[model samples]
Target: MASIGPNEIFFLLQGLKWTVALTLIGFIGGGVFGLLVALARTADHKLARRITAGYIAVFQGTPLLMQLFVVYYGVALIGLDIDAWLAVAIAFTLHASAFLGEIWRGGIQAVPKGQTEAAKALGLHYPSIMKDVILPQAFKIALPATIGFLVQLIKGTSLAAIVGFVELSRAGQIVSNQTFRPLTVFALVGLIYFLICWPLSLWGARQEARLQTASR
Candidate 1:
């Protein structure tokens, strides 16, 4: 069997770009959709809140793997032509949106009731108050949580490998199969993931600390 060398490592690093691309696609798409969902849930109307909650429930309640599989097969069953990357991106966005929606909703709710009362006392409309006062504050609290969610988002992109989206995990598997060194190849992949994720985790923790300090 041929041993891994610099060329193989370089090949693996090329796969990292796809992983990062998927992570970016997932985060941006999920964040925008999630913000809308969070905003709906935070709206004054009961119907809006209930609808958003149901969306979250369905996405969060089901397994993400199943969601991916359903999209893959379901699209084909419907005679729709979809590529693996597109399928994975859609699945990731759907899954991430639910969790991020819930996280932002909690942040919105956590803003003190007194803040709302004060906004009303100032002759502000609900939208004006939310836009000018409450949401700004809520976003401050949401920052750390959002950052924390980003770490998970990066890691979650690995699931794309399931549907033949040759990301980091899929790249590792390819290398191992070619080299016949599963343990070594996978261990290196794990190390690469750790290198990527550890800094984000630390940064998120620091952001959480700063927000808490500012809160106090």
Candidate 2:
């Protein structure tokens, strides 16, 4: 068996770029789509609300691994020839959107009902009301949860390996197989993940504290 060496470590570190890329794609796509979902959930129309709720249910209820499988293989079965990276990106985006939508929905609802009423009393349109008043407050409430979800999303990218994306976890698996050092390889993988996630968790906590203090 080959020994784990500098080259092996560098190879694994290279996977970090894909991990970071996937996280960015997931968060950016999910955040935009999720904002729409949150708005629909909060809309006056019952049909819109129900549709967004169902979307959230299906994505959030299922395992992300299954979602990735469906996106990767199911698309291939349809003859689209989607890239594995694209497939992983799409699946993670949908997965992250559902959870984010729910998080932001709660944040929207948590805003004082009177604020909405007051906006309407000022004869503001729905968009204006939301844009100028409700969403700002909701964003503050949502920031911590959004950050938390993003951190989880980053960790969850490890699941992309299941669909053949050789990210950090997959790199570890490969290194372990070659070096016959499963424990050491995976411990290093865990440490890398910790290094990425710990700072985000701390930032989220600090933001949450600041929001609470501002609220009070």
Candidate closest to the true structure, highest TM-score: 2
All candidates' TM-scores? 0.92, 0.94
Task: Show the colliding residue pairs in model 1.
Answer: none
The residue-by-residue lDDT of candidate 2 on 1-216, one tens digit each, is 678999899989988889999999999999999999999999989999999999999998899999999999998887899889999999988998899999999999999999999999999999999899999999899999999999999899999999899999989998999899998899999999999999999999999999989889
For model 2, the superposed segments whose C-alpha errors exceed 4 Å read none
Q: Name the runs in model 1 displaced over 4 angstroms.
A: none
lDDT (0 to 1) per candidate: 0.87, 0.93
lDDT of 1 by residue, 142-202 (tens): 8888888888878777777888889988898999989999999999999999999898889
Q: What is the Cα-based lDDT of residue 96 in candidate 2?
A: 86
- After superposition of all CA atoms, the RMSD between model 1 and the true structure is 1.7
